[model samples]
Target: MSKAKKSIEVEITEKKAGNGKTVSEVYIGKQFLGNVREDDNKFLMTTAKNESFKVNSFDEGIQELIKEFHLHH
Candidate 1:
């Protein structure tokens, strides 16, 4: 018999914020993962753990966050 390993899946959503800027929110199985926002051509992201970081690219934030959580093997 073989056991199935659990995998991590993240959901990403991009929407216009009230400031009229693009905001991307990440969620993992209904749990708030993190959010990345665009400001003055820079990207700022805050993790669900309240850890804030600056990223040059929008996707970098969530990708790093996932790595931080050790979600991928």
Candidate 2:
């Protein structure tokens, strides 16, 4: 019998703060992963298989990452 591989999925969001700062919110299966400052300019998310992604624009990057997760899983 073969074992099934686990799914590594996440979601990202770009939020604008009242102070005019932007933040990137990351989530994994409804759980909040963490948040990164917009000034960072780059965010990396990795899976157990060592596959990872580098996001530039938080908004667009989140959308594309979600799409990639769907296609990969």
Candidate 3:
């Protein structure tokens, strides 16, 4: 028998608010994942996951989610 591999699709969308600022929304399939807000070159990530941890960068967050997906598979 062989183990099955799990995969996840991350979709990111950027929108302009009434204040003329850009915000991003991230989605995993049909589920709402979270969003990221940036102000003056500062970035913040708000994700909805089973567990939470601090990641130094946005790429790290994506990597962590990939690892989590494989573990749950």
lDDT of residue 43 for candidate 3: 56
Residue lDDT tens for model 1, 1-73: 8989988789998989888888898887887778999878888998878888999988788787776666632
User: Which scores higher on TM-score, 1 or 2?
Assistant: 1
Q: For residues 1-73, what per-residue lDDT tens digits would candidate 2 score against the true structure?
A: 9989988767667789687977676677885544544445566544334455666765555565465546665
RMSD of each: 3.4, 7.6, 3.9
Off by over 4 Å in 2: 1-3, 39-73
Deviation from native of the Cα of residue 64 in model 2, angstroms? 20
Model 3 alpha-carbon drift over 4 Å, by segment: 48-57, 60-73
Worst window of 10 by summed lDDT in candidate 1: 64-73
The models' CA-based lDDT, in order, is 0.82, 0.60, 0.63
lDDT per residue (tens digit) for residues 1-73 in model 3: 9989766678878888778977666777876565555656555556556345555666665566555555665
Model 2 lDDT-worst window of ten = 43-52
Model 2 CA lDDT for position 44: 56
